[model samples]
Target: MAENVVIEINNLAKYFPITSGLFFKKKVAEVKAVDGVSFAIHRGETLGLVGESGCGKTTVGKCVLQLYRATSGEVIFEGKNLCDLNENQLRPLRRKLQVVFQDPYDSLNPRFTAADIIGEPLQINSDIRGSDFDRRIAELLDIVGLAPYMADRYPHEFSGGQRQRLGVARALALQPEFIVCDEPLSALDVSIQAQIINLLDDLQDKFGIAYLFISHDLSVVRHMSDRVGVMYLGKMMELSERDEIYKSPLHPYTQALLSAVPIPDPAVEEKRKVIVLKGEVPSPINPPSGCVFHPRCPKAFDDCSKLIPQLKDAGSGHEVACLLYKTSWP
Candidate 1:
């Protein structure tokens, strides 16, 4: 991971309107997919975003890439605010920021050949043409450990892992400085997942690319990320260095989540007490007053239900949003 910052996301929020009626006219509520999330990714580093399903992990990635227009926030990439850029202004910057979606089967076009698929971005963003384009495509396939001959084949002819490799190849065509890996390994088999993860690490080392990796798997996040952020109900609950977050989790929610990860050693697993959460995640449409996790948090008290806990520094750059760590509550 490089020391220079590559992307900055500040107070980002994304909401989807829900309408239900005879005429489908009235806006009943808004799905608060992402709300007031802020983080920064440095060049050549991987920032893992982890949370349960529907916790807005993927939405943060899309909002950063400007794929989904944020309700409010600033996404500054390379010192420029991407939110203010129009379509034409964003076109050039698209090469700098790329995304790899989760579904290999759905993300790729069935009709397009692998060569065409990977070459599309290069063609749009760069002036490389004729033999140069063909050569570059071949090199990309080789870089991704795919045979150059496979380029002529369509997406359907490939297996799930192969299709994902193709997607990676496409994302790499631009030689992007940063990538939003939106659960890219979730669709692959366990064995294939290892291979893809190894490949991503190698590519990062070689190209010096930064990654905003979003996933629900804490173990995977631990392996790949330099820093990790835990989200719940569209709000960040914890943020810290990967090892610190795993080793000494300050928040009760963080401790509960880590306790659930199965230990390979039977003795350790038996000795551990899993802190099972008390309630289901609160609806983001109408989040609970005070801390959103108060309903599920074991350590929550009267003040937790009355005043929202601010994300404050616990120690060593670790931050947590919980009343237990606060001076008043403590």
Candidate 2:
């Protein structure tokens, strides 16, 4: 592990196997949801993951949280490989890693009151209980900008934004050092999204927690992340510093993705030429032979279909898995 690195992943891969015959199932084909995707989340820094739907961005977050076991490779957190740890070993470490899932309504338990939902983690993981737990729950609600009075309300009683605040409150209850904020803003109103974003920023500043913020919204990712990683069909197309990724995208897929986001200013938006790809994203079960984005790439050549491009340092820590950046294609 390097200095200030909270978590490091190397060639992480996850496959969901398809089966036939209900009684005696036989393996058919597997969905390569996440294949050879690697990146690091530093202490107190957010690493934004952006891609089209079914591009394995969410799977990456789940795998890091150990919600979904990786089929291969390593997930090193705080110098220990999480992939090697079994359920018993992972139970204790679970306190240090938490998740704020997409769809606040779907993630929360509708039957449980806000207090129950937030206090559940503490009851399971810590000794704080009764009045101490109550006090902690109140503090958590305050941390996420929720009133203590609202703790008695059910998930259905609160607004979408308030429910999301409840989810955040629960995640913070354990005081985890790292969080997997999976599309935390996608389900909320635009104005509400701003509130949640600011709350996350304030939480990070106060607690020095790292985040793996996953979403399809490029603008939100740009605002929250220190560095961004682009994935396409389970492969990381590009990874670079936030500003560099936006100003100068190296991968063709990355360029196309960024171009699609509308600029705020009409003058710039009118002048900008959006790079539209030709075909739909390929299925993960049967991906392309080589570069996953080759079928839709504007700059793809014959070699792109023949060789798998490894992510290499283009310059200034900008890693791109595009053959265009290589000297000699073999």
Candidate 3:
């Protein structure tokens, strides 16, 4: 791992066992949620993971945070392999590694006030209590652009955007070095989404926090990410710098995904080609043989159905897992 890299996930895989039968509970199949996914998040940099729903984007985040223990592979954070750590050992490290879930309304406790929600982490991790804790909670509320007086109100009282702000405040309560923002803006209105995005940007700049931003919104991902990774059927199809991936996507899946993003200019939009993929995504329980994307890939050949293309560099920090780019690989 490089000194600048905050987290390195190498061949990270999470599989859920699918069982059948009532008495015996026989293992019938396994859902390969995240399989052989590899990437690194640099210090203070945002790495966007974009894919269609059920592509295992959220599963990757959960695996990194150890919410779901990975079936295999390593999640190395700050020179330490998190997979080896027990729950007791991992608990201490949780403060430095936080997460902001997609649904703010569902994630936050309705029974607790804003102050209680934000202060709960502080209470668990540290000895700060009484007026000190109150002051800290107040400061956090202010930091997230909420009034300090709003601390007394419950999560139900706040609007969708405000609830998200509170969630960000709680994540920031521990001053984490890395945060997994799992589609944080997906639930909010279009206008409110921008505000939350800007808020996250500002917070990242101020705190120098690294983010593994997972989303299906290509436009939003392109806007916030320093680097982007494209996933399909539990495999990473492409990875590259923000501009490189958007400008020249190497993989067929990546190209198709980028093509779907609506252009701002009417004239350009009219002229641009849309690469619509055929058929629905295959079930992860029994993915396609060899290259999982071969079924729908427009450029796939006979080799694609026989061999799984390794993700190799196509120069200039761009990586793609496709036979088309194999000649470029060193």
For 189-243, candidate 3 gives per-residue lDDT tens digits of: 9999999999999999999999999999999999999999999989998999999
- Shift in Å, residue 80, candidate 2: 1.1
Per-residue lDDT of model 2, residues 1-330, tens digit only: 789999999999999999999899999999999999999989899999999999999999999999999999899987789999999999999999999988989999999999999999999999998899999999999999988999899999999999999999999999999999999999999999999999999999999999999999999999999999999999898999999999999888989998999999999999989888997998999999878788888888898889999998988899999899882233
Candidates ranked by lDDT: 3, 2, 1
> Measured by TM-score, how close is model 2 to the native structure?
0.98
Q: In model 3, which regions exceed 4 Å deviation?
A: 327-330
Candidates 1 and 3 compared by lDDT, better number: 3
Model 2 stretches with alpha carbons more than 4 Å out = 327-330
lDDT of 1 by residue, 110-169 (tens): 999999999999888999999999999999999888999999999999988888889999
What are the clashing pairs of model 3? none
Each candidate's TM vs. the true structure?
A: 0.96, 0.98, 0.98
Number of the candidate with higher TM-score, 1 or 3: 3
Error of 1 at 41 (Å): 0.4
